[model samples]
Target chain A: MPRRTCGNRAMIWALRLGLMAGVVLLWEWWAPGGLLPTPGQVWHAGIGLAAEGRLWRAVGDSLSIYVAGMASAALVGIPLGLAMGSFRLFGRVVDVFVFALAATPRVAFIPLIIVLLGLGFQAKTFIVFLGAVMPVVLNTYAGVLAADRDLIEMARSTGAGRGRIWRHVVLPGALPFLATGLRLGATIGLINTVVAELYTAVRGLGGLLAIYGNTFRMAEYFVIVAMLATIGVIVTEAMRAVEAHLSRWREER
Target chain B: MTHIRIEGLGHAFGAVTALDGLDLTVRRGEFLVLLGPSGCGKTTLLRMIAGLLEPKAGRVLVDGHRPEPGHDTAMVFQNYRLIPWKTARQNVEFARPGTDVSGYLEMVGLSRFADAFPGALSGGMRQRVALARALAAEAPILLMDEPFASLDAQTRELMQGELRRLIATRPSTVVFVTHGVDEALALADRIVLMSPRPGRIAEEVRPGPGMREYLWQRLREMVLNDPGSDFYGREG
Candidate 1:
């Protein structure tokens, strides 16, 4: 069984690599007079940026903002959401406003954020936070609401106090939901980081995209886009790893 | 000695009355079963005894004081209600922290699966963990609300026998609620039959040679006459 699973995994990897190679070859062939950069051109552009140390700086800048924004969102959103779920009166009172804000497009607030915080790291981080927080809050709230009532009653019957019940049953039960929220929050935060860099200040990978696009550096533009995609994959994969760790008990094996 | 006393116990869920003007006394070391059809307030009464629910119109006293869970009683739920994230051993340990739980897990015959989470266990195994947890608490009263009802027939019978053996050794005052007549006959020292909705004590009998048939007939009659009973269209 183990050997069969290993062979299956190898086959899947082979298929993935073949598909990627096919896509790159197609893109190379379809490139029409600078309309798009060839894969080789994009690779060369990426190497040039790396040699100049600009790629590292942009990655560092973007990642720092993403991390800061995500941390803040988790800090504020998780507790608030849990409180909303735990306290009936508080939840009823605040849910309308929360849902309303979540419904509103976060991009609309960029202008107001710029007016208040200006084109700085704070502004960029706040923008990411705004994009990321709603998902975390909403998912956490839903998770708490979905927590099993029977488990709560069982804990109560075992003489667990409110705090103990929250710790042992409620929090652990909602972990899968919390993990989902964090994963969503991380993805949105990365998007908001790019948006912040593009709209607010010309910095990070987003700044590189704007510069390359404006200068008609199609190869460099493609490189930055690829870098952004790579960052996105890394962030999402990291979130997934964390989620799996948190919910290990959910799986039988 | 009276271990538990419920006097004029009445409760309602919004507009729906669950239990009304109910009175009962449980003796120490006695295995008493509350047998009733669905929506007959057996679970409601058990929860009240477990101190997870408060009566709206009356009171429950354990040893001459208000009943408090973990102090007077430990409950085994119909759904098992074992914490899915906790291992069987950890779940048993949770009943009373800082105590060795191996003995309780062993008693339930789950020592080998101690590290397995509730999700990994079968329904019977999960309930065993719940039973272990309740047992570990060492509370003087054990209140079970159809603890084996979710299990298959064979497993239910096995669990009933296991429970009887376990109770024989521990000798705690037990109040078990169930709709199964065979289950009551197998485990209870005395069975209290409950009427349909707004449940009241209909009959009390000591289990003997013809008790199962008698109880089945009574349950059938109740189900037939009580149109509003949730047990309608279901076997007694």
Candidate 2:
């Protein structure tokens, strides 16, 4: 089984490398004169942008908002979910509001956010926060609700305090659900961050892409899009690895 | 000293009476098995003894105090309801994880599976974790509801031997509920049979210190000559 797994991973990597090589070769056949930049030439443009600090600045600008927005969502969403899920009264009180928020189309609020908060990073952060919180909150609630009743009963029967029961039984049960939510939230977090940035004249990848698109700088535009997609994939894969490790601790071997 | 007593124990679920006017006394270090078919209130009685449920019309006294949950008594559920997320050690520690769970796991012969999670365990192994949790409670009374019924015959035998050894060593007052006549014969110091539907004690029979041969003979007599003498065909 171990050998098969290794072979499969190697095959996938080789396939990816081959596809990347093939795509670059095709791009070389279609350059600026052919209405597309060659892969080698785009690499050169990317390097020139980096040397002039425009590319790095755009990258840095995008990352700050992404990290800040996600951190805010995580900070608030997790605690709120844990509180709602672990306690009946709190969960009941917020149940209607949570469901309503979950159903609302987050993208529709982009115009409203930009209007209210103005053409700034704050507006972009607001949109990302709205988008990122639902999964974390919902998953956390599910985790708490799914906690084993027997385990809680056993604790109660053995003179464990209410606090102890929550700590020992409730928290561990919710960890799996929390990990799942956090993984999903992180992905949507970046996407919403970029989408929110596009709502304003923000000097980030989203804005850059918008400008590049209008000016027909297709090469730079595609490169930025590719970079964003690659970043998303890498972040998601890393989070999945962490989630797997956490989930496996509670898994059947 | 007496460990427990149930006086005029009666309970009804709204309209349908599950248990009616039952009385039982458990002496210290005695192992009493309550035997009955399903719907005979065996589980209810066990729950009452464990303080998981309260009698509507009676009281349960343990060591001269009213039985209360989180004190003086611990129970093993038949379903082996081990928490899926918890390891065997953690489940055994469900009652008191920081205490001497190692000793309790050894009592149920699951010391090796301590770090193993419930999801990775067999039905019998998980039940042993339940047994260990109950044992680790250090409660004076132990109530088990058909804890090993899910296990195969061989594992059941092995667990019975373990229970016997545990009884010999700790000597707590035990109330075990089971539907199987042979199981009651093998385990109990004294056996009380309950009739089905509006359950009540039909007969109290002691099968000679729970010896193998004595149980065999009692099993024979229980089936052949007077099975209905106990119930009188009054059940619905």
Task: Using DockQ, give the best candidate's number.
Answer: 1
TM-score of 2: 0.86
Score residue B127 of candidate 1 by CA lDDT. Answer: 92
Could you tell me every candidate's TM-score relative to the true structure?
A: 0.95, 0.86
- Among these predictions, the greatest TM-score belongs to 1
- Fraction of the true interface contacts (Cα pairs closer than 8 Å across chains) found in each model: 0.81, 0.53
The count of residue-pair clashes in candidate 1 stands at 0
How many steric overlaps are in each model, in order? 0, 0
Candidate 1 segments whose C-alpha is farther than 4 A from its true place:
A1-14, B230-236
Provide the fnat value for model 2, as a fraction from 0 to 1: 0.53
| Model 1 lDDT per residue over B1-236, tens place | 89999999999999999999999999999999999889899999998998888899999999999888997999998888888888999999899999999999999899999999888899999999999999999999999988988888888889988998899998799999988888888888999999977889998999999887898899989988888775532222
Second chain TM-score, each model: 0.97, 0.86
Candidate 2 docks at the CAPRI level of acceptable
Quote the TM-score that chain A achieves in each candidate.
0.93, 0.87
